[model samples]
Target: MIPLSRNSAVFGLNIDPIGHHNGAWRHPLTQVSRAYDISYSLELSRMADAAGLDMVFIADGLSVNRYAPDSVVLGFEPLTLLSAVAVNTRNVGLVCTVSSTFTEPYNLARMMSSLDRISHGRAAWNVVTTANPNAALNFGPETLPDHDSRYERAAEFLDVATALWTGWQADAVVADKDRGMYFDPDRVAVTGHHGQFFTVEGPLNAPRSPQGKPVIVQAGASATGRDFAARYADIVYMVSQDLEDAKAYYQDIKRRARDHGRAESDILVIMSVRVLVEQHDNAAQERAAELAELVSAEATLKRVSSFIGVDLTRYALDDVLPPLPEADDIQGYRTQLALVRRLVQSGQVRTLRELATRLNGGQGVLSFTGDGRSVCDNLQLWFEEKAADGFMILPQQTQRDAENFVKFSLPVIRSKPFGRQRPEGATFRSRLFG
Candidate 1:
């Protein structure tokens, strides 16, 4: 297990160009034209790095989401985009999503190792077994594997990738001119990995990176997903609706890690939060209301339908969601589907319209809209209560909202006992698990 500083919290920014809210692109302050441009992301990375944030995470999918227009799609491939951001920033970690189901283990190892070298050892991989069934079509498959099956493949994929990453020992390179030796060839070993999903005979072409191996991140909340994460992930990005849920998830994952003979502290659990920060509470509330007003019910329904693998449009806006299929049968995000199901069964969420609106921001992540102080207070409470190790900030409006949080809330957060400031010359692994 990686050792972490006691009482210190880790922070990351989830950079979705269009913003986390469904209506953010339509907001008056948002520059829709720059959503696809690399400069925009570059600027955001600079801002985040300046704030001493730990990392900048880019979410990806194999195909554009069906509910939204192509304009709102993730404009850059995650690795290619983060590689660009890596040279521009000095301290912040660059994490990008890559699907294990569609990608070859050897190729992923090489790409991540290359990025780690390029960034001087600040690369992280968010491992995902693509949840979007549409992703299957892109990869020439008629259907996505079942929930357990995908996790099974992901587990094997990680095993092979890790083996490839460890192909060359830390001291493999000799670089001796007098002896005419570039490397100690005996120190490098081939990874003869043969598994149910992959066959990789690799002594990765790329040498060992500065960090030895880039950090591994996973985002899965179902039973199988949690087991997979406990066994392999260095960090877990999660979605929790409230404090209780967050606490439960935090304890469950940690305990599971222990069961796997791993230290709980080795895996950092960061929850996703959509922040709407303004100078005044009233303004923040007003901005949230305005954004909500802009949400497209039709677009939202289609989006939710795609997420749960159900045609939600068939039900009336006022109707509560009916019972869902078992997770074993669902091809989409079964954990998320179970979460929404609980909300419906508990009467906390009543109608389809309400669910659509709630999910519009951060896709069911906890949302906090208030002045900077209030935002700080909320984060502190979560950290203190053991509900989360930290949060992945997803701004409601990319420019104004994100900038406001960094300019205002970040200072307050850093001033607190649990808050952290990045150390000089800190590598991503050190900053994450200090």
Candidate 2:
């Protein structure tokens, strides 16, 4: 049959696995005590699976404790945690972040391949070049690598990793007990990669994964980042404050993908979405207000200062965000800076204090608070504008909000004529993009 054409899709959510917002766990109704519980995370996975979500993702980093006063602390190791969730859920894709800068490609490839085996083709890798300087120090470096170098090394890292993953041919895992051999050595090839960054030898210890090589998910938004995604990513996770900008970004990515000899449909673009739900619209608004109030401006200043590597402590609250003398040189979160600029240009906020409040609560993704219909309306506008292939839903405050989306918004999304459908046990990419 001819390949089907589709305009949009249902994307996954990025659960901090701990929590997304800084003060999310502090909500009176939130299950704060269960934040570290494996069962709690599994329940989330089950909820999304029942709702037919494309996937459930968890972001990770090597270092810890460097969050805004209200920022959530991610305590669980993402890949390991996702493996646990994998056993509990039936269908939803399980995604985990693993930094290319800090990990050896071979080990990462083996672990992800094992996850695919355990999850039955429902695993993905959210490749990241972690930004926190503390993370760099933890990885045996006093100074963080420059942004250009990080991406450069990341590109080669992908090449070596993918080569290793693909080195083992499919059907090599024949458990022929009669022959006293588990597999055929003839099908295994070695990846003799000698590059500027990494030197890896031989085929991966694991067999070829079910989805070929687990889907490549990328979250970089800079020029180099976009190019990297174009070449390697099956899914792109991004943050945008407005639909128009999202549309522009979508168009650019499709263009880039084509220039790189890929079809537009070959890549999925999903935005990080913040959802605030309640029994009614008014209640949802009230919850948002409560969440906003929990953030301390002083805390915001501290977080933003550390985020930008500038201490805003001595500056007057009225002062502009310290001139980013090395703004262009800043690594890791260009998306955050762009949103800050938009808010500044729109006059929605003045002073670094106000900017901090707006940004510190959510991780600078699009924020919305309303009942299901309103939420769907906002989402539809984004999809129609070609601003997104789908969204990574992040519920604010508690699991109640996430539950509300499953009960209310998810059915509506499923009814929409977007996304792809595959056989009952298709791979994660097949379910996400068809």
Considering every candidate listed, which one attains the maximal TM-score?
A: 1
Candidate 1 regions with alpha-carbon error over 4 angstroms: 1-5, 65-71, 360-362
Worst 10 residues of 2 by lDDT: 416-425
TM-score of every prediction relative to native: 0.95, 0.92
Model 2 lDDT tens row, 49-127? 8766778988776766643335566668998899898888888898888999898888988999999989989999998
- Across 1-434, the per-residue lDDT of candidate 1 in tens digits comes to 12334887889997776788888888898888777899999999988988888899998888865545633766899999999999999999999899999989989999999999999989999999988887899889898888788889888988888888888999999999999999888999889877798888889987899888889889777888888998899998888776787898899999999999999889989888889999889999999989888876766777666677778889888887767776556778876776777677667788888888767644576788999999999999998999888889999888778888997798888887777675744568977766
* CA lDDT of every candidate: 0.84, 0.77
Q: Show the colliding residue pairs in model 2.
A: 22-70, 22-71, 22-72
Instruction: Give the lDDT of residue 368 in candidate 2.
Output: 72
